[model samples]
Target chain A: MKVAITSTGNNLESKLDLRFGRCGYFIIYDTETKGMEFIPNPNKDATEGAGPASVQLVASKGAKKVVSGEFGFKVKSIFDSLQIQLIVLKDNEKKISDIIELLNHENLN
Target chain B: MFTIFVLNICSLFMSPRPSRLRKISNPPVISGFRPYGNKNIKGKVEAVFLHFEEYEALRLCDYEMLNHHQASVLMNVSRPTLTRIYARARQKIAEALVKGSQISIEGGKIYFDSEWFLCSSCGCYFNNPEKQVEIKECPLCKSTSFSVYAENNNNEEEEEEEEEEE
Candidate 1:
């Protein structure tokens, strides 16, 4: 399964972005193949409807789960309908690499 | 004057529309029920559709044993509306029992309430967006020791007060 984690920077060393919609980058990590891709958030500077647009970007990548610090009010129902699981990690200091490690542990279980 | 009189007559004949959607704190664990051992019945029994709101009403009132006013407050609906839903739930249950029809619980003008959990190891709060799957561990740290987070109600009340002040 592919997991999408919002990040503050392009590299895995950066902390997890608290805001899902305006996150600087999205890290797509595939568990089976262990491939990672970083896509710059196109809606990072969007004034309106950034949440749903970001959702579309992640959905298009076929990520089954989304890890972010927070999701907007409008994005929950959309994700619920799409059957994409949302994982809200409230720790602002958690890095992308730590989250990826957790995901790997989850896959092993 | 004549057009106004006709409009008043039309309004009187029209049915009252339903109120806003009710908030359901918990979704039903099972989808529905099935009837059996009815030799007198033929093939393909008719099924009664029960709304999720009705199931919640029944649960809050009958199972949880809360009063109408309290249940309505939890559901975010009026007492009378809750009583009406409860009544419908009973009536549907009775109809299904008598006719041996399957009861299928699905579809309603309702919004689900997400529950938050606190990870003791990570000291982080996260909400379970998917209700169908059981959360076994913390999403971040994979910790087994966690508790259900319940501070959101106070936060909501505070936000409401802030809105009122603004």
Candidate 2:
């Protein structure tokens, strides 16, 4: 299974981005292969419909679960329809590395 | 006055639009009920399709012990509409009981309200996007200390007051 986490930077040490649609980067982490790929958000500066666009980007990566600080109202229904699990972490100080570790722990359990 | 009267007459001839979709705070746990042990000879047992909105109306009015006006506000519909829904729900239930028919709860012009949760460990608010799965721990820190966030009734009251002022 693969999980996507919104991040403030392209590196694992970057903090978790608080906003989902306008996040700086999206980290796609594969559980089985333990591989990570960072995709810069193209919709970061978009004035409208950023949430749905970001959802499309993440969906294209085949992410089963998404971790973010918050999700927009428009994206919630779309995600629900897609049957993609959403995990909200409120801690803005949380790093990408810590989130990946938590995902790893969850997979092990 | 003559133009206004003509406009009113024309409006009366037009068909009324459908009611707005009711907002359901929570989906029912079970799909519906079934009648059993019927000795009467029957070719087929008729099934009553109870809409989700009607089920919600029944729940709010009967199970929750709320008045029609209060339930209407909660459901985001007018009081008359809520009463109509409640009446329909009761009638369907009664029909199902008397006729030994199955009651299936599905299909309605309703939207499910998302529930918000507050994580004490991380001090963040989040909502459960998926309704099927139960949330056990905080998604960020994996902390179990959390609480279900309740809608603030005071906010609605304040909004009403502001509208009154306007």
Candidate 3:
């Protein structure tokens, strides 16, 4: 499955409505092929509605799963519509590579 | 100094004829205020009320330290409108801290800012925590299988392209 991973500057990733207007970088991954790619978050300037834009960008690229520390309501809605999955990373985790390993583990379950 | 003086004079003249300065809006009022140094008292204020939009304005203007223009862009609002929101937020926060009043955040027209989805194929975006995501066709593209996009060395280049597009 195609997956997208995002890195955040902090913990406390809230619901998308509360934090939709923020943007960070994302890493796209494919579980079956173990392939990965990068896409610049176009919603970086957003402080409130970053969710919609971020989800749209990922959806446009055909992402099926999105791994990140937190997400907000708007992004959640878009992901719901596009059928994109959201993965919550542990608090204080910064490295995207570490999260990828976690994702690999989750895929097994 | 000169700008303030001109504004005062303009206000005096325009007060009688509102149409002359219809486009020039008044700066938002400070809803509350009190001295900060006297906060050692028993009834000291511990919080400040912030309207959602006003807090949004503060985040956009003060915390982010964005200029009115930049703030306007970020909030998807006009510079004048952002200025009004920022002014109100600063006033409320100042009042709460100075007057020893518990801040109760409220008011201001706000809306959800973004959209999202849960991938049906991977079950990544599903809301229910208990239910398992059943694999189907890829919801994003209707494909049975998919892969993530490759990272390109296009940060600077893409920024340049965006600027050009703008």
Candidate 4:
């Protein structure tokens, strides 16, 4: 399954982004192949409707799960309806690599 | 024919208004209750459906020992509305008990206050979208030390949560 994580930067060491819609980049990590793809959010500067637009972008990438610091009220229901699991991590200081490690823990054992 | 068209528009305004959405803090743990130790009828027994809002009203009033006014405030409904819901709940339960019918609890115009947890070891906050399953350990750090996050959406709910080791 592909897991999407919002990051503050393109690098693995960058901290997690708190805002989901306006995040800097979305790291689409495939658990099976251990591949990582960072896509810059096109709706980062969107004045309105960024949440739904980002959901469309992530859904098109075939991501089944999303890991983020926080999700807006609008995107939660959309993801819920799509049957996509949302894992909210409140620690904004966590690096993107650490989140990847946690996601791998389940697959490892 | 002209009068029939006007009557159709009049019927639209004559219907009663829909009920307001009740805010539920915590959903019931069990979906319903079943009666046992009864024998006679072999086939399936009749079921009494209990609404989620009615269940919340019962929990707030009977289980938590709150008055109708206080329970209504918790449920985001008026006192009289709470009373009506509570009355319905009691009536259903009574019917289920007397007739040996199953009590199935579901379906109501209600919104739940999302439940969130705070892991003490990792200092992370997470919400459980699936309310039925229990969270034993922290999803990120796998730690057991945690507490319920009392969201300050508007109410000031104070808690000094201390997790005990088993």
Candidate 5:
């Protein structure tokens, strides 16, 4: 399963971004293959409709699950309809590497 | 001139106001229900479409035993509207039971009320989006010491929002 995590920086050491829509980078981590890809958010500076646009960016990558500090209501409905799982991780100090390690657990359920 | 102005004002009142979106506290765990042992039945009836609002109305009015007015306030609709939805829900359920047709819950103008959980071990807040699967551990810390995060706090916040809107 591919899990997406919002990152404040392009590197794995960066803390998790608090805002899903305006995040700096979106890290697509494949749990099965143990691969990760970072995509800079195009809607990072958007004034409006950033959430939906970010959702499109994330969805297009075919990520089955998303990890973020928060998800907008509009984005939540879209994700719910797509049947993608949303994990709201509201820890400001959490790093991308730590999250990846957490995901690596055989029983992360 | 006065008569013309009166007629214009009457026309403005004729148009219906935009409806408020209904709030669903929780989605149904299962999508829909199917009838079994209906091979002896004469015909296959089309599935009954149960709106989320209707489901919520039935749940509040019948299951939770809340009166129409109380249910309406929870659902963000008028009392009469809640009664109407409850009526339709019962009608559809009765039809499904008698006719052996499937009942599908879907498609309504509604927004969700999020339920947040707090993990004591990790000191993190999380939510369970999938209604079927149970939350077993903290997503980050892998701890089972989590609790329902903000039951009273959320209620107070919602009440505050209601006051602000009013």
Candidate 6:
């Protein structure tokens, strides 16, 4: 399954599969297949409504799961509409790579 | 090609003569992807408080190279306020560069200017306001500047004579 990680800089993955239009980049990883693609977020100039833009960008990447730090209500609604799995950071301290490792472990079990 | 051309045409209509000024406001926002395989779990996120308005001011007056008076008018702030903003901005930016802190683009008592400027010299562009003071020097080059594709009309006679000679 292709999983998309929402990140800020090099750490902090999205806990839920949500992005504000303001985020800079996304990393797409294939859990079963071990493929990865880095995508720059497309909504650099969006003045408002970041939730829709984030969802559209992720959907374009054909990702099934999303991990991020926080998910706004508007973003949560869009992910619900799109049926994208959303996970937020539990302790708000886990690094993005650690989250990816956890996801890989989940897939194996 | 069509889109770029259309954007250029639109830009021409937007600001025929860009002023050499900057504003004081929130800092530039930065967002980007993580490098692959950065698994280190412990790093403190640091923030530098330059404010977006401060950045706007510097961009207009310093980078865009507008005089203080012109930049103040573009930002819709009084000249004195702009001067203060610019000074503070410079100090903070200098500090940030020296100290290495994350610059945050939040919380400022500033508003966006309605007008924007395009540089005639290097094609570097900025957004500012109309009714600004007349600017003489190019912000980037410090030379007397003109608008892109703008003809001085007075130079036309000289050009005609040169053409005739040729």
Residue range B14-73, candidate 6, lDDT tens digits: 766542344333335452112233345347535567666677888788788999898888
lDDT of 5 at B137: 79
- Candidate 6 lDDT for residue B84: 92
* Candidate 5 lDDT by residue in tens digits, B1-166: 9999998998888876767778787678788999988987877689999988889999998899999999999998999888888999999999999888999998777765555678786666766666445567776567789866657786898999999999
Candidate 3, residue B123: lDDT:
33
Off by over 4 Å in 4: A106-109, B1-59, B63-112, B131-137, B144-146, B153-166
Q: Considering every candidate listed, which one attains the maximal TM-score?
A: 1
lDDT: which is higher, 1 or 4? 1
Candidate 1 per-residue lDDT, tens place, B1-166, comes to 9999998998999877767778788778798999878899988878999999999999999999999999999999999999999999999999999999999998888866646777787776766665545678987667898866666775998899999999
Candidate 5: which stretches are off by over 4 Å? Answer: A106-109, B1-114, B154-166
Arranged by DockQ, best first: 1, 4, 5, 2, 3, 6
Each model's iRMS: 2.7, 3.4, 9.7, 3.0, 3.3, 22.8
Model 2 chain B — which ten-residue stretch has the worst lDDT? B124-133
Backbone clash pairs in model 1 (N, Cα, C under 3 Å; residues 3+ apart or in different chains), count: 0
lDDT of 6: 0.59
TM-score of chain A of each: 0.97, 0.97, 0.72, 0.97, 0.96, 0.77
- Global lDDT scores for all candidate models: 0.87, 0.85, 0.55, 0.84, 0.85, 0.59
> What stretches of model 1 exceed 4 Å from their correct place?
B1-65, B68-113, B151-166
Q: lDDT tens digits, residues A1-109, model 6?
A: 7777766553344332234456666878787787777676767567887667778888788887666656677876677667665544434344456656665665554
Lowest lDDT sum, 10 consecutive residues, model 1 chain B, at B125-134
Clashes of 2: 0
Considering only N, C-alpha and C atoms within 3 Å, which residue pairs clash in candidate 5? Answer: none
**lDDT (tens digit, per residue) of candidate 2 on B1-166:** 9999998998989778877878888778789898777878468887999999999999999999999999999999999999999999999999998888999998888866646677786665656655545678865456788866655753787899999999
Locate the minimum summed-lDDT window of 10 residues in model 4 chain A.
A100-109
What's the ranking of the predictions by TM-score, best on top? 1, 4, 5, 2, 3, 6
